[model samples]
Target: MNNKLFSVIFSLAVAIALVGPLFAAGGGTALQHANVNVRDTAAVQRGAKLFVNYCLSCHSASYMRYNRLAEDLGLDEELVMDNLVFADVKIGETMDIAMRPADAEAWLGKVPPDLSLISRSRGADWLYTYMLTFYQDESGGWNNLALPNVSMPHVFWQLQGIQKPVYATHDGIEVVDHLTLGKPGLQSPEEYEGTVRDLVTFLDYLGEPAKVKRKNVGVWVLLFLALFALIAYALKAEYWRDVH
Candidate 1:
């Protein structure tokens, strides 16, 4: 029974490991790994800057405060206020946008959702791929392979340039084969990828600010457990020696 149970558990674990990436991709498109490290304060800071300049006007990170951001990224409060705080918001205030919901809905056809937990809801890999996959559709409008018919426009076009989709027939229906850069952007492809990576890294940090500290604590806890187990085993051996 023990062996049977172990086999079943192992099989389930293997299956889950194999299938997990497909679900993370969302909508059948393979996701690019974000390879983000929230512990990298410099990357997080760059991502935060990009978020504020590009995404903040539409999406608000209401859960995160400017003071907390400054503290986490090791920035002086004054520097954050001068650089990051675009609106007339106080340093202690949450990162709320000036755009009213009604106005945003009228302009965008929908109120942009708050992005405080976007990375948690849609994993970092999905977000990273989504950022990179925006392409010019036949209608000359922006579309994404990661999220078909995405309402958002290609906001990073200036940096990453225009990507045109290449289509190929598969089973009588045309499908996107790949994307090609038709126009060059300000940054090289490598530099643009790095920029997107930094942005995703910030989003990842935003989702769970305590992740770094929690991971550190977990390592210490595992070490303590191993030490305790060793001590317990030594006591057990000494106690049994007399009886033997």
Candidate 2:
């Protein structure tokens, strides 16, 4: 009994040792909810437009193709070609930029990462919050609340407007508590938030274009399994009636 107790205790200790870091790692910052719905076709379409206009210049969605946009976004091939296709890329080619890696590094101090899997890698909430959190700092550079000291500039600053960090002194050190909107941009705060939400929704769809189809298939598969189980149970009952 004593040996068994020791073994159980040892197992629990090992388990706790393994699990403790995961909890510690997760305790950093609370993320704001993105509330993104990729099924909203209109929002996704708007997001796609926003991406093509603002984000595509620097970041490339290498895994996504222009024709795929027409299929997924309910856009006409002609509209996509006329409006979204800027480079000499064909309709079937993957989304790529003309900026070379060395040029990108020289211009932006670092090469921007491909955004094809960014939504999957970083949660939708993180992306949404990051997009909206850029504020003017002391060094005249933009700072993000979600990701501190981000290298990327606020490309959408014209739409979202300028924000300055509100700071409070704590123990002789000033710390940024929140942001205050300084200059009004082309969009109101509410409008900008909605735009960001739509953009995040589009990114979510880009990360997994087959997500909706997979969900539909999953539901059908579950229904078929349930029906099969019911029929099997009924057949078993019929066959075993005489034995019982």
Count of clashes, each model: 0, 0
Judged by whole-model lDDT over C-alpha atoms, candidate 1 comes out at: 0.92
- Residue 49, candidate 2: how far off, in angstroms? 0.9
- For residues 1-244, write the lDDT of model 1, one tens digit per residue: 5999999999999999999967866666788888998888899999999999999989999999999999988899999998998798899999898889999989877788999999998999899999999999999988999988888888999999999999999999999999999998999999999999999999998999998678778899999999999999999999999999
- Tell me the lDDT of model 1 at 216: 75
TM-score of each: 0.84, 0.82
Candidate 2 residues lying further than 4 Å off, grouped into runs, are 1-29, 170-172, 226-244
**Each model's lDDT:** 0.92, 0.88
Clash pairs, candidate 2, are: none
User: How well is each residue in 1-244 modelled by candidate 2, as lDDT tens digits?
Assistant: 5999999999999999998754542313456788998778899899998999999999999999999989887889989999889888899999999999899999988899999999887879888888988888999998888777878999889999999998989799977778899888899999999999999998999999887567768889999999999999999999999899
